[model samples]
Target: MVAFMRRRTAAALLSITGLLVLALSNPAGEWWTALQQPYQSEDLIKCAYDKCIPEGDDWFMAHLNQTIHPFLTPQSNLSAKDFLWWKKLQRDPNDLAAFKRVVDKVFQLFPEGKGFMDSGSQRCRSCSVVGNSGNLLASHNGALIDFSDCVFRMNGAPTKGYEEHVGKKTTFHIMYPESAVDLTDNRTHLMLVPFKTRDLQWLISAFTTGSIKFTYLPVKAKINANKDLVRILNPQFIKYVYEVWLRNSGGYPSTGFLGLMLAIHICDEVNVFGFGADQNGNWRHYWEELKDKTLRTGLHSGTEEYRLIQKLAAKGKINFFPGH
Candidate 1:
């Protein structure tokens, strides 16, 4: 009887040790930082390397068509009917042939699947959508943000001096033709949120013949990003976010809002930070100093978007850390 008890105690000790090792190896960071807190979406991001999805665009478009159709439209069909929708989005495909040329050129520039496509026992895939809100200034969420499976940063939110608050890791950087900036590393994926066909034309030109430079806003003739790591947003997806999600409340959707929706589609669980306004009710970026008292979320309905974000969080679709 004594020998049996000794063996059972040893087994229990080993089990306890294994649990401790698992917890330390895959730390859940912000979601379960406290002992009593329940596990959240951010808790699922494992530390293993991300698996790249083969022929990613085909996979994404296939999924989008089935579920997020019309809203999540891709280049499944660049026909006249699709061009009409693009025209409605202010793309102005005045000539069908010219529009086809633009679409063909864009198709050539589109990159294959690069990250988080695998769905095996190893896939946990938690994502963090880091906005440029002033609330992140002193939040010191850098460690927490970096712990995510992927971090999506938008609109030139720098991390050099602000590493303590925003974290230095960026798995994906989302931008538009006008908002594009030179990336410091090849590891982060560069996702172009093209607003119009000219934006797609600009991307092809920047990487190929280098003819187009100025758009509605002047842009760089060339950008620094790995060609293989680049991805472009479907214009249909943008329109979908505008009409279906935002319910056509604003002239267009903000890049941050669109970025969040993209994360919702790709990530298993998403954690949002540095979004919305700051404590003083100033609608400004964390990097900015001057305050605009009359600042509004240009062309995007800021009030409704905030409300929607709140609703998503309440519904357990996301964990929103409104630091301010």
Candidate 2:
């Protein structure tokens, strides 16, 4: 009996020691840090080993060149003449052949739905990436923005309501489920940002509501009953965010960056509009009409990334607004 008592005391002491050790340590740190960190799409790609630049086009070009090269058909590899012509056209393909190349590469990647194919199914001409900016107001972009085969919007863009400011035609509503459902009205198209794993549940719930259908995307998947409504992006593409990008972008990739990376991967030529904050660092979307206009705290985390965006835009590698 004394022997048994001694063994019991030792075992109890060991169990308490183990519990104390576990209490002091955090096993979840590895995964928790990964989830909280900033990320980019290209960083998640196969060739995504390099870090991001806070300012410069050289890295942007390297990433774009690598990401787009694999998907570009031999026909669209831009000879000097086509390159010069593209410069003249501002990514607006006037010729049907050029248009088809863009469509085959870009639109083929977007999952098909009944309304997925627009009026000009085989061609994408004069695509206007309408930034959700108050600037479009009286700027007279109505004729310019309505011409694309597909239109994209971000973060509670009000198109039908502010037709002059935000533009009337919204073919794609690209944003996170929380942002899309929170900020947007019924008619605006919904492009989703699948950041968290479960946001897809909300995405399908929104789609089945039948007010406006959505095409939920690549970084995340919809595993629910209404998963049919989603158009998922490949996970190889999503790895670009974690493995290559978050480290470079300092924390997270912008929604615009994600869309741009996707466009670079899928489109022949890409044009970005109304990206980056204005001259002063303020977070405002196209749909917003701000009275203060002073920099406000918000989810659009563009403070550190603007210079990087500017450098790329100036290099003629990308099209970003508020030119230097």
Candidate 3:
């Protein structure tokens, strides 16, 4: 009876181990990351033609509703303390109340109710995070970049002259006061990456009466973007991206890093273009001939960010096109 029991136990263990091995070897196991969309690619450069991140579905929507809804909701009021806590705000001793007022006003500017790309409304939204790397100078990826459901451009990477290399389609232009540009495309959404309370004030004044002109840096007095389409980045969301997504890589998150994080939340599929250094190992913009030796990424760690981006590509979370 003891021998028979031992045989039965050994047989059961073997069967269970085989089943586990089969599941692990399958396409939907540890071999493939859950965050990445399904794709078949033999090369390092992946093409996400129909791939969509599963998290962008109802599961993510429910999670956002339960956690991030308060921060995104327009009716919610954000105080100066909230801003200070989230960001490393160095405000004047006398400007506390004024800062709070600006925060409140900025929150009011946010679109009321749920986001337009909520669970019920969103489909397989493909997004392209177009950076200003010089690698895109002669790539002629305009049509390919434009084919995406939405294309995000950062700073003032213009498409007027470089239409063949970088598409003219700008679904969203993410920028701060210093990098602000006049949006000629009426359809483009002007998304603000507010680094400080003064940045928010600049945005408000730019759209309304053009009152606040000068900030820590010189800013555009007025922008050509539609007032109704302006979207402000939530301070809390910025903190979340910094601490949670980026694991606090640098003192503060770079605008490019923040933009990619934003894309992950809103886009079902993400394809990145015009990011990282060029073939010559110089950090330069596609529109300019000037190249910086240091590859200045400001307060943020640019190299680390680039590696993280590459890691994401390997995991299939994003289809990273190395441009040149």
Candidate 4:
């Protein structure tokens, strides 16, 4: 009996020592974290694409900060501290109280009740981010783009005539006040990328009062969109994309880049189409004629954005279909 007790005591000591060693080795307590919170670890956390860290691509996981919420909820109120960085993009001068009033009015109408896409589920959501680059002209990606679980389009990218190239199905249409267009399909969610407090005000006014018509330039007073289906992009998310993803490369990320990042956050599989310049190296829309061959991105770093997109494709984070 004495011998057996001694052996048990020795085994307990060995186990304690092993645990101590593990604690020292993992100072961040990552192993313990993984065990306690399964699938929350960077290695185990699956994106909407149904994968965590892609093989041979540590850069993506390293840069991807999951703490950022990409959309504004009714509870997501921007404090004065957060507004300091957020206001820099569009030089918004509105105070915190003024911003809150606009936001309150917005939620009153939109009422982000629940069932947002941020919540993870067993079902895998695939997405196709369609840009308006001229490269999509000849490429017959319409069928493929529409087949995705979600299709994201930006600005005034019309799909009536170019359905053969650019898909007819638009799950989400992203735009600011200046670029806002009336959505004929009530099924499509109108995602407003609010650059300033005015943008939020515009969203409310466009749907109701139609009083706030002008920003830096004249914007549409009223927009025909489904009030229930309207969504607003979080301003903090824009700052995150600027600092973390783009590394403050451009003045700010373009609408297309923001839309792509949104897909990455919410979808299991992301497929990109209609980005970058065309074969002739002209930066023109697929539907429009090349009036100016020298046309290029002014505010945003188009070149740097394209480079990052290429790197993402090369790293296998996204399957890029560079339309011909």
Q: What lDDT does each candidate get?
A: 0.69, 0.43, 0.68, 0.78
Question: Considering every candidate listed, which one attains the maximal TM-score?
Answer: 4
lDDT for model 2: 0.43
Give one digit per residue, the lDDT tens place, for model 4 in 1-324.
Answer: 224224433643654466457678887755333222211233322233324214345788777767777788878867677788777778899888888888888898895833445545444455789998999998987756765667899998999878768868888999999999999987789999998999998898998889988999999999998888888898888888888889999789999999998888877667899889999888878888988777798788888888888998887677799888
For model 4, the superposed segments whose C-alpha errors exceed 4 Å read: 1-56, 77-79, 113-121
Across 41-123, the per-residue lDDT of candidate 1 in tens digits comes to 55443423343222234423433332442221224445565456666655554566776577666666665443454445455
What is the model-wide C-alpha lDDT for candidate 4?
0.78
Q: Rank the candidates by lDDT, best first.
A: 4, 1, 3, 2
Residue 312, model 3: lDDT of 74
lDDT for 197 in candidate 1 is 71
Candidate structures ordered by TM-score, highest first = 4, 1, 3, 2
Q: Which prediction has more favorable lDDT, 1 or 4? A: 4
Worst 10 residues of 2 by lDDT: 45-54
> Clashes in model 4: which pairs?
48-267, 48-268, 49-267, 49-268, 49-269, 50-268
Candidate 3: C-alpha RMSD after superposition? 14.1
Better of 1 and 3 by lDDT: 1
| TM-scores, each model vs. reference | 0.75, 0.49, 0.74, 0.81
> Which of the predicted structures, 3 or 4, would earn the higher TM-score when compared with the native?
4
Candidate 3 lDDT over 97-198, as tens digits, reads 666677678657645434544533224566788988889988877755765667899887888878768876788898989999999878788888766767
**What digit string (tens of lDDT, one per residue) describes model 2 on residues 1-324?**
224224433643664465446556747444323222322333321111122111245565455434323122223333444333332312332454444454354334333333332212232222345555444555544423443334566655665655533445654556665454333234444455544323434454453443323334332232122222334332234335423543344334566655555554443323456665544555566555566776543433365445655655565544444421
